[model samples]
Target: MKNISLRAGRFLTLGLVLTGLGLGSCKKDDTTTVYGNWTQDASISAPRSESVSFVINNVAYVGTGRNPAALSTNNVYGDFYALDPSKTGSGWSSVTPMPAAAGVRYGAAAFAINNKGYVCGGYGYVGTSTNITYLSDVWEFDPATSTGSTVGSWRKVANSLPTPLSGAVAGSIGNVGFVGCGFDGTGNTNIFYQFDGTTWRTLTNTYPGQPRSGAMSFVVNNQLYVVGGTNNNVATTDVYAYSTTSGWALKHYLRNVSNSTESYDYSAVSRSLGVGFTVNDKGYIAVGGSTLTTCYEYNYADDTWTLKNPFNGSARNNAVAFGIGNYGYVGLGYTGATRLNDFYRFAPNDAQQ
Candidate 1:
């Protein structure tokens, strides 16, 4: 009887050890699987594209996109919605619209500085094609007051450079805003400009990539990167980086591992015409034509591109994306024939997959 009891104890110990080993293996696999993926958290009702979205104080604000019905009409939306990621259930609420009706302008650029959000440079119409205007105007909105004062309103910044341009990508470091390559109403340009809150200065270094529109640009590690865009509807897979002292240089070419010939084009979407941002030291590209929901991530450390889970909400193009913390917010844009108002949050996790 004593011998039987000893055998039973040993069996129980062996079973527990095996169970622990199994669980450990499972956890390891899960962690590895989800290391670089984005999971959809909450969806908000935000319909419109060619709009702008940005995050301030852990909450996101989305507003001003083209109206769904009259695609050509320059009716800018004034409705402002706020998103709180920490809140459960419904996470978005309407705050206040802009003071006046701005016009419908796709490809406008937006960025935040000192907690204030600025919307700048896009094409819109006052009445006709003759009246169809490209604006170099800039507007400032403060989330704290939930108010917009076009008080300092539209100032023409680029005097020495080309005429009013749209589809320009912009990124801000400190109080300085950098605008790079885009369409100047007639053709794509490689011009680079910097705005020091009060004035604009054109940088002499020309970007090496082909003159293209709709490319994505972002700054990582104090270096600016421009990725896939279109040259007259021809999509490019080239990626370039620029530094203040070094000028523009090629980083890596994004090649389609699945197809050597296939390339990304007008499909590339930036926060503006050419905008990109860094999250977790990895760069994420969201929203583009041809492949709307498609999302790609770049590991700067490895210089490799990995296709992550596609954006879970409406597949769209010409939308805007901004990062607040661990999550990235995307909203507004055209999904094929229809304009979208839905908002989505992408959360990157380290937990087991």
Candidate 2:
């Protein structure tokens, strides 16, 4: 499920300077209050984009994406890492890499369930520019059973997804994990599936939004919210929610629509491949396709979005994000053909300094 690649914009450095330091008369500068503060954290081991990430037992595991610098060789990453937000003093440590047999790939979907993390369904090049393979194989990573150097082990799941997919979004609610909506080689799809850590079952209902790929999914209040993605080559704004008990229903549109009262622009929220995570009962989407640093917060109670301070990092897409405790972590993405290793911790409710 490759995006209809948007051209990367050129990098420009901007600086702010305070004028009239010694002015005889001066006016007090107005203090503007802003929500959300991003603090830089440990960088990932390497720079890559379109990676997959999941959290298990408060530890984030990230791996498997394309490295822009390795394009000529068509090398995709299989190396994985683990970072515990409570113990960031140790930084990120390498976990066991994904199996070589799975074939290095990008645009995969990941979710954690039953204390284990699972990666499934992505597409990869087959040693040639013209040859691409869509994947349906599923792999599970168990950190508790790991050996030295935090090296976890992976095992292939017997029942993979029914069809090959890429650019899908995944999340787990209580004991059940859900995956849905991505390209299935021919075109984008709205199909969805659920796994109880063993067998896979197709959901009786498909996603109700436009068929999409590269959307963002995050769980808040035990409900799965699927928002923003490309449909028919254009970024979509529709937002949808699903719960095991209630099935699927359309939520507020990401843009300022008939339902919203806030005047702040939400057009920036319409994007694909952005990072989405929940913090302090609210959900945030940041850094995505067409290259943006803007971050938006979703309030499920009111079905509204509030713009936060822009991401402290450079504008990017295909970044990976995970929420632990009260903070959300975002990092490792592509900015203007440049793969980034820098990471940041965002406090969406904090006052920006």
Q: Who wins the TM-score comparison?
A: 2
Q: Which run of 10 residues does model 2 get worst, by summed lDDT?
A: 1-10
* TM-score for each of the candidates: 0.73, 0.86
Off by over 4 Å in 1: 1-46, 72-75, 87-90, 101-104, 126-130, 146-162, 256-275, 350-353
Distance from true location, Cα of 141 in model 1, Å: 1.9
List model 1 lDDT by residue over 1-353, tens digit each: 00111110012344446777884234332121323344455554656666666656677776666666554554555456677777777666776655444444656677666677666767775323435577666666676662354221222233323345677677776666677677887788878777666566787787777877788866666677788877877777778877777877775555423234332322223222322556756677876764566566666664555545556666667777777777666666776678765566666443313
Model 2: CA > 4 A from native: 1-32, 69-74, 125-132, 147-150, 258-265
TM-score: model 2 vs. ground truth? 0.86
lDDT of 1 at 81: 68
For model 2, residues 1-353, the per-residue Cα lDDT tens digits are 11121111111122111233453235644333457889999998788888999999888999988887555325577779989888748898899987766667788999999999999988775334445588898999998887555678888899999998899999999988999999999999999999999999999877778889989989988899999899898888888999889899887665643323323335657888788998868988898876688787888887767667778989888899999999999999888879888899998878765
Model 2 shows how many backbone clashes? 0
Question: Candidate 1 vs. truth: CA RMSD?
Answer: 11.2
Per-model C-alpha RMSD: 11.2, 9.2
lDDT of 2 at 352: 62
lDDT minimum window of 10 residues, candidate 1: 1-10
